[model samples]
Target: MTADDHALALALADAAGAAIRPFFRGAWSEERKADRSFVTEADRAAEAAMRALIEAHRPADGIIGEEYGTRNEGAGRQWVLDPIDGTTSFIAGRAIFGTLIALVQDGWPVLGVIDQPIAQERWVGRIGEGTTFNGRPAATRPLKDLSDAVLGTTTPHQFAGDDVDAFMGVARAVAESKIIYGGDCYNYGLVASGHIDCVIEAGLKLHDFAALVPVVEGAGGMMSDWMGNPLDAGSDGRVIALGDPARLDDILDAMS
Candidate 1:
């Protein structure tokens, strides 16, 4: 991947972010989904706007999005987008939410960009091109064990008590642990940058992962499901990612 791919990925995410900005402070009625997740007027509008932008810019490429779903899935090059990753937080007046856009070539993420409009921070990365938060390069810290790591996850509060207990077993063994609630795609950026050691989640879709995969991989980390499989569209609901592979196994083992 080169500067051009990174540029295009960033531009796409930025366009999507702009589309979601208007609904930030505006009043929007909420609606519940089958899974109990909330969706607002902004979610649908942003996703539609993002799909149009991707179709216009990457004419031949396929597109996948959270709200709009996918049009073409078998294309060699596809653009996956999540217009507002943390919709609940977005509607709750929190700025921790952002847009996730990624370019996947031949089933692998080639470029990724997470645009946090509220924080005025944009993370751009390309496979083998390294990763950057804003304009500065970012890389994870060298903590080799979960025992000394400060782990961050999307949400542990909502998990089943038994599942929470299972995870907390791993957490209690760690030096520190915290939930970056409503972090969405931002937590992956955090793990890649070394501010957080890990970002575990139980439920996710393709649009949920597209943008973060490369950013984490570019920063010399690994992104995979809890069962030690690659994160494809059909990935298990659980995900485990770490900069240090050895420590990752430790975390996974503790969970098991």
Candidate 2:
């Protein structure tokens, strides 16, 4: 990605944030999709704002967004966006929700940004570069063992079938009271910032996880599938983000 690409990604986040701030904590129309997930006016508005910017600034590039569908599907570089990653939290007036933006080149994420509009916190990451939180460098904290790790996930309900059992196994491996629930993408941002040791989640979509990989990995962390494979556009949605790469085997073993 070029410097201009990075700037455009940040601009997308800013546009989305501006579109969302007015509806936060204020009354807005909301509906449940076929998957039973909620979508609010704020979500559509934010995504519309971002889509407009992308179409104007980089009309040749593709876009895959949560609220709006894909455009320019055959383009080599695609912008992936989730206007409101934690819509439930946004509806509850929580600031933990974020706008996720990612630049995927040839199906691999090369740039990412997680923007918490309410708190004005932004984490930006690019391939082969350090992550930055609010314009300063960010790094993940060291962790020697799972026993010493603080683990997080959006919710246990996100898992189904054997995935539930797999997640429970990892949860059991960590110390009591060290597991946290319900932060969605914010939890991954925390992992990137070194505030959390790891986050394991399942059933995520491309838009849900594409932005997280760069942010976490660029901050000295690592992101992969449960089987320890690298993530890509075609990943099956079971994800593991570790603040310390040394714990990958232990985490994979615990999950298995």
Query: Among these predicted structures, which one has the highest lDDT?
Result: 2
Q: For residues 4-88, write the lDDT of model 1, one tens digit per residue.
A: 6666776676666676778788877789988888988877877787787667767778888777778777888888888888887
lDDT (CA) per prediction: 0.76, 0.95
**88 Cα displacement, candidate 2 (Å):** 0.1
Candidate 2 residues 61-137, lDDT tens each?
A: 99999988999999999999999999999999999999999999999999999999999999999989999999999
User: For model 2, what is the alpha-carbon lDDT of residue 37?
Assistant: 97
Instruction: Give the root-mean-square deviation of each candidate in angstroms.
Output: 2.3, 0.6
Best by TM-score: 2
Every model's TM-score: 0.89, 0.99
Q: Which ten residues in a row have the lowest lDDT in candidate 2?
A: 247-256
Model 2, total clashes: 0
Give residue 110's error in model 2 in angstroms: 0.4
* Pairs clashing within candidate 1: none
